[model samples]
Target: MTFEKQVVLVSGAGRGLGAAIARAFIENGAQVVVNYRRSEAQAKALVEELGQRAVAIQADVSDPLEARRLVNDAAEAFGHHVTTVVNNALGDFSFNGDAREKIQTIGWDDFLGQMDVALHGSLNLIQAAAPAMEAAGWGRIINIGTNLFQNPVVPYHDYTAAKAALLSLTRTAAGDLGPSGITVNMVSGGLLRVTDASAATPEAIFELIAQSTPLRRVTTPAEFADAVLFFASPWSRAVTGQNLVVDGGLVRD
Candidate 1:
């Protein structure tokens, strides 16, 4: 459970679950790189709070060049060695009425937008970071996913499909990198109550979810972040290509 002497990178870490993950790593003695797109102020404040162990860098993961550049910047920050990579960034949450048109009216563009961030962005980061992690002979890759893909109670088609692809990618990457001692896994959770991305979900819906879960409460960013840490820690050395869901028993599959 100790991240001492580890260097970790969390994409889209300026706020929400990403930010929580970044803070957790920093608090555990890991040098953290907080990747963000437009939250410069938030990122800077986080860096300041985390002191010298944290760095705030702006990079859009969906863009291949920026994704690679972010890895390069992180390498320079820590002399070409990073042991952990967390793919937690997403393009946008268009669910809950953000769509101007229903699926019958919306083009495939909506789905691709979601796919680009998780699939494309994750592949880019894995490619950029794999070499270094392999050289170190120890690495951790945690892909963020959603439990909605399992339940589909609300039918967020685009988002659920994107997450499914990410889950598959996690397994494939684990298989490919297993020999190199790099473990790739996914942490899927039900709707988190406080993330800005989930803010659009109606309070009534969240209440229903809380009531359905055995825990009687919606998941929190901190709780999900702990799962990320588990996948990153030495304790999970033999576990790879696995999707560990933390949805308060709401999604048992």
Candidate 2:
């Protein structure tokens, strides 16, 4: 319980990878904000399951105004200045009713929307969380990223582009906040099989990734969450602006 009593806000935590990340923080004794956009029932259920340490809030992080509210709500819930922020939210991909939008067919609005959630959404949270971290003289900002951006196996251009932009923002934020004891880093992973959000990925693609990876296993949400916790921990005090890939050596970045 190294993080006992600490406050952590995780966006898009109603299900999938986001939910897993929230659980990890709670297990580590951090008071967690389980943020979601539409899954109210799931969010409330999670909060009850986690007991008093968890608070479920609703916000569409892709919208900058709502993004700010998520942070404020978490700080109020935890009854402390937040010390950790996990920008793990993403937009829903309908993509004009196609299975997936190709680069040529993808519209600029779709691309910007994804970027808004990954890059601008991250920035919004960071801006809201930074003042408190600076006041405390310490903080952690962990950005969730995709291994596909490192090397696209399926070629989801819009999602990949947004994640790449997030990586760029992570480094720059680290540079800006280093003197204040706040560390910003990214946790990039290959296809995660356990997350609900990833369940739509074809099984063949997952098998191919497993074969390609050095460990011959797909990275789990919990495994990816562990890497995120490391970056947020005191042990990584001297570390910042680094993309810690947790995909079992599939793509090193």
Candidate 3:
């Protein structure tokens, strides 16, 4: 389906990669709901910048009630049930390899934190949005993932483990929701050139990754965001339960 006919909701869209995704949807002619947990200032500013097509709403996706409210509010704002949901919200995290907790020292809580936002968060959104999508008979759910599941260059134990579970959810949800005309998929990326979470990564690592990739450059948020759009676009109507990697070929899968 064309984006102009869709109402898209992007979680954690106040800044960083989330913001880029929100901007891409608005540019593609979709009315967007920019979901944010904290970054209120940035979220409001983005809504103002995006004009009439975008609205910013604050909700913690990890909380089922809040997630449900977010979906309802989005439908109310746009006069249509959300046709697409981007599960991009993440718990507090940083990509500094040297600073990451090693498997030996990382606690279960670390994994739980990420899962709460990634896996549980996606579950909440899916449960909340599915009924409406079933009624409309069309929907798109795109979950942001990481190439680390394949390469694990930095071995971010907690983050990688949580995202792996999210990939599993993406696939199973696709199966369960496909009959209702809803497709679920994932877009995974390697170390992004720059984002609030990745800002702590050493420049040397970025350069090394760029040199290793076939593109000889790091992936930008805008570039990754475009892959997400493909799933929501009519071009990928038959695609589901798939993970498209947008890391400049860093992880060939």
In TM-score terms, which candidate is top? 3
lDDT of 1: 0.88
Q: Kindly report which residue pairs in candidate 3 clash with one another.
A: none
Off by over 4 Å in 2: 94-98
Regions of candidate 1 where Cα sits further than 4 Å from its true position = 94-102
Residue-level lDDT of model 2, residues 1-253, one tens digit each, is 1578569889888888888898898898889999898999999999898889999999888777897788788777767888899999888753221377777787888888888788888888899889999998889999998777668756478888999999999999999999998999998887787677777777777788799888998888888899988987878888899988889899865
How much is the lDDT of residue 97 in candidate 3?
88
RMSD after Cα superposition, model 1: 1.6
Model 3: how far is 134 from its true place, Å? 0.5
Candidate 1 vs candidate 2: which has greater lDDT?
1
Query: Which residue pairs show backbone clashes in model 2?
Result: none
Candidate 3 stretches greater than 4 Å from native: none
Model 1 over residues 191-246: C-alpha lDDT tens digits? 88788888778888789989999999998999999999999887899999999999
Superposition error at 100 for model 3 (Å): 0.7
Q: What TM-score should be assigned to candidate 1?
A: 0.95
Q: Give RMSD to native, each candidate.
A: 1.6, 2.1, 0.6
Descending-lDDT candidate ranking = 3, 1, 2
Find the candidate with the highest lDDT and give its number: 3
What Cα-based lDDT does every candidate model obtain?
A: 0.88, 0.85, 0.96
Superposed by TM-score, candidate 3 places the C-alpha of residue 216 at a distance from the truth, in angstroms, of: 0.4
- Structural similarity to truth (TM-score) of each candidate: 0.95, 0.94, 0.99
